[model samples]
Target: MQDQPLNAADFDAIESTLLKYGDDHSVLNPSELDGYFTALVSSPEQVDIAEWFPGIWGGQNPAWETPDEAKQFIELSVRHINTLARQLAEDSAAFAPRFEQTEHLGHDVTLAEEWCFGYLRGVAVANWTPLPAIQATLLQAISDCAEQDNFELPQDLDVVAHQQRVAAIAPAVRALHDYWLSQR
Candidate 1:
């Protein structure tokens, strides 16, 4: 079966539909959502863009910067990342392309949710900033993952195999993660 090609337009349609339904169960505020979308549009990356579609990880980029700047970037990045993740959890259809297997759907979602949250928190706390909202977004993403009790298969989607793909980018995320951890 051909994988579903879910792009920005698909997500935008999903968002519009959700808004028309008058649901506010999103993990982020309006501005944060905007920030996430803006980041994607301005500079498309793999890890983040993959977030809009299910079962696909747009492998996270490693960050590099001075101590103070790193802290600031972490806070903002977490806020934006969690916001997009939250939107995914809220509207699964928009992301159904990623979850192609029923048996491990829940597990995958949970992993993704936790990974995003843990990575966000790990980076944020590592930086030691007073960005409470960023922390809240991370917590919220975790909560959303916890609330899911079932799994579904992603239809016609592209799967990002973490192992096969990390070859080129592991150093960056690790360096960023380690740098933040070192501050503690």
Candidate 2:
């Protein structure tokens, strides 16, 4: 699916069951997606990229509450997408392309919806596609793999290749990226 703005309703539905802390937008800022990679590279050095969130056990108490839950949300989204990737790689032949970007890969809306709004919501409220662009890419790639019965994601692949796979899966990634930048 192409990148689109998630209105208040989408956010409301996601945060509906979760306990409200402070301003939900601050806790679930879309800008985190851009800052995440920078934070990963600048470890040990302090940055403004931080937020309060729940505890390790999924508890969101008063004292231990994290200021931002972006990291948790990204991790959850990544795990969901990676699982699909591994599955596609394991059975490469059974997959097929879903997006027109690549020969076989195509967009996978179900994977995107499930991971973005479903699994990610389990931990903290997320702003939908604003966070899961990377995950969405992976899910699309997995969908492509599914089209072919002999498709398999390479095990020894590096991060760049993984990114290429994601890019190929979703042409909308650029739109998503631009939307993310607009959110900043």
Which one is best on lDDT? 1
Question: Which stretches of model 1 miss by more than 4 angstroms?
Answer: 1-110, 127-153, 160-170, 178-184
**Candidate 2 Cα errors over 4 Å, as ranges:** 1-52, 55-124, 129-174
Per-residue C-alpha lDDT of model 1 across residues 50-166, encoded as one tens digit per residue:
343221112232233356543443344445455444444344233211111223423332123323333333333223344247444443443353243323335532334422222
Error in Å for residue 20 of model 2: 27
Q: Estimate each model's TM-score.
A: 0.22, 0.21
Clashes of each: 13, 31
- Using TM-score as the measure, the top candidate is 1
